[model samples]
Target: MFHGLIPADRYYAYLSFRDIESMPNKENVIIIQTVGAVEQHGPHLPLMTDAAIGLYIVGKTLEQLDHDKSPTIYVLPPQYSGYSVEHTSFCGTISLSASTLTNVLMDIGDSVYRAGFRKLLFFNSHGGQPQVTEIVARDLRKRHSDLMLFSIFAWDLPNIAATLVTPHEFKYGIHAGEIETSLMLVILKEYVKMNLAEKEYPPTLVPDGGLLRIDAGLTYAWMTKDLSQSGVIGDPTEATSDKGEQILASLIASFKKLLLEIDAFNSHV
Candidate 1:
């Protein structure tokens, strides 16, 4: 086994480092599941923008962690295509039914469990697939009592977002908003066309904004179109690369902290 951190980011050479041999022996190695949809992100952003951004942030976070000896983290290849039925009406959006999305996560979880990495983190970037990941995480936790499963949204780093964004932008945590656009600017600036970015708020009366309760019978709620008119929730025009960097930095810090806590929890188990 490697005596200490490898000072390297790529764990598996052939694949995207999800293989067992490439996995470091470091306790509670995180198997990051990059979940996003092939849905429209408005005129400025590409359909694969969400998945691409998620993968990049996870990879960058792992690289920084390795450099700091924070913890041994591995980046798993992203699920480029996922459940996105709501946006299917749009030209660029590709979606699978909710059930299909759930199965995909379950299968992926089984493989990760078999791979000897007991700790799994579903780092979800797309809102549409939250339930699927949640279902897999909960059930997997029950079936494999020795394993630890968690799902996190990359944009949940409010502290970092606050610093980069104005008070107005922070208030609206909707999709393809200032935060996401800024992130795209950093991750895939070439793909972004700022001039085309437009704001379109969805009708407030839409039931899609209604609450969800998994146990009570509502499994999934809300679609992209339900929230915005132009398929954009917040202001994308305010996006800046500087904001993207800070947001990413905060995400890495949060990931480091969360992993350490999970590792400590697993140590006793």
Candidate 2:
């Protein structure tokens, strides 16, 4: 367990060690941690697009909690490097091995559980993070049966925001597409270059591009080169800040619901 007060930052790192330590040792007190990736988001978006989007959502979630009088949730610092070996095919993408990330998450979970925090919610902003963190969460649960832990891919929350984007774009907007671009437009406008926005509908790596033309859902793996030369899928040219705001709002609301539900674990346990 950590001793003494750990400094807190509102913007960059957010929560600290002391913040979680000082909180009541109840099920309602949860540690919210997240990990993102520093990878290419097409030419229009910056290399840190994943980080910007993930951190912004985390920051907003914490800001909302400050006013709420329900559960006590602490937003720990956001980790930048996630599982992104598939993205290293493109420039500016830094990634750690799956085993490395999984072990790191397990250690963090173990420390948090030992520090008197019973519930730890992992919020991953990268597509590859969910698979990695979920495995770690399972391992933690097996080691400590009383600890309540779960990991979610935050980007998946925006699935309900599909209406905010074009029907065509939404179907193929898997990567640096309209959905991601619109979110970035609101989260970090300065880092977005609308002038460089372009559309690319890459063919699926699977045979016949899989059922219903859903390349990603195929039971196979692929790299950026197999999809697009520019390291992007879907269309970013049509992204708008207004759409970004709408999607972000929905994501925040969804996150709050999950937090409250998870905090109430004691009632059922």
Candidate 3:
């Protein structure tokens, strides 16, 4: 029951102590920890939006893999709360401090390493905490040189945004906008308040020949309040379940490929 969408045998917590001890090739086990956030995703989407998306992606990807032929992969329980200081002004956001998140992830990695696993991957869905995961991954690697640590942002793996959204939405819809809303529509349709969805974008100050931007090559420190009053930074009005489905398919395909590659990867260093 605790396994949720993940296969019962592949859910890390489902394994008994003896079961884990008996597992063969423990060094090759790919332990994925889905990192998400409990934060504001505008009035239209739930606070669990980020967490739900990450879990769904990981769960679906695992489902599609051939257990016997694919690399040994198991998923830890999802980390539902993450660093979300940028959305703290909103009512639903529950943010962990950068240090707190870092320590939590480090502890998880340490436990996994202690349990005889050599590989750990942080599959994060929130836009606010990649830095924290990256820092934790590097620090953990420094501590355990033999541990294989990997981190990835879920949305960064797919290139379907341009096909599903407008050019303007593609660039500014970095938050609870079209991209996320569409995904939510498919992931948690009943929870989505489509009627309440609104289009909003932050002011982009492209000064001195586009030298400055919000989410571009050169960015600034900005909170949701600074750019948008609606707690949204993208056009959710354009989101549709069709687009969400397409996006999910692309993401799953890419994720499956990545997992296989990680299985075969060996560092020369």
Candidate number achieving the greatest lDDT relative to the actual structure: 3
Q: For residue 211, give model 2's deviation from the true position in Å.
A: 2.6
- Candidate 2: 10-residue stretch with minimal lDDT: 1-10
TM accuracy, model 1: 0.80
- Residues 1-269 of candidate 3 have per-residue lDDT tens digits of 98887788789998899989989999889999999999999889999999999898899998998877988898998899999999989997899999999999999999999999999999999888888999999999999989999999987896586887888788788888998999998999999998999988877555545777787567878888998889988999888899999999999999999999899876645
Q: Rate the local accuracy (lDDT) of all candidates.
A: 0.71, 0.76, 0.89
Q: Sorted on lDDT, highest at the top, how do the candidates line up?
A: 3, 2, 1
Tens-place lDDT digits, model 1, residues 114-156: 7777788888877666767888899888888877888786666
Question: Over 4 Å off in model 1, which ranges?
Answer: 1-27, 166-168, 206-221, 267-269
The local distance difference test score of model 1 is 0.71
TM-score per candidate:
0.80, 0.87, 0.97
The alpha-carbon RMSD values of the candidates against the true structure, listed in the order shown, are 5.4, 4.1, 1.3
Clashing pairs in 3: none
Span of ten consecutive residues with least summed lDDT in model 1: 1-10
How do all the candidates rank in terms of TM-score, highest first?
Answer: 3, 2, 1
- Candidate 3 residue runs with Cα over 4 Å from true position: none
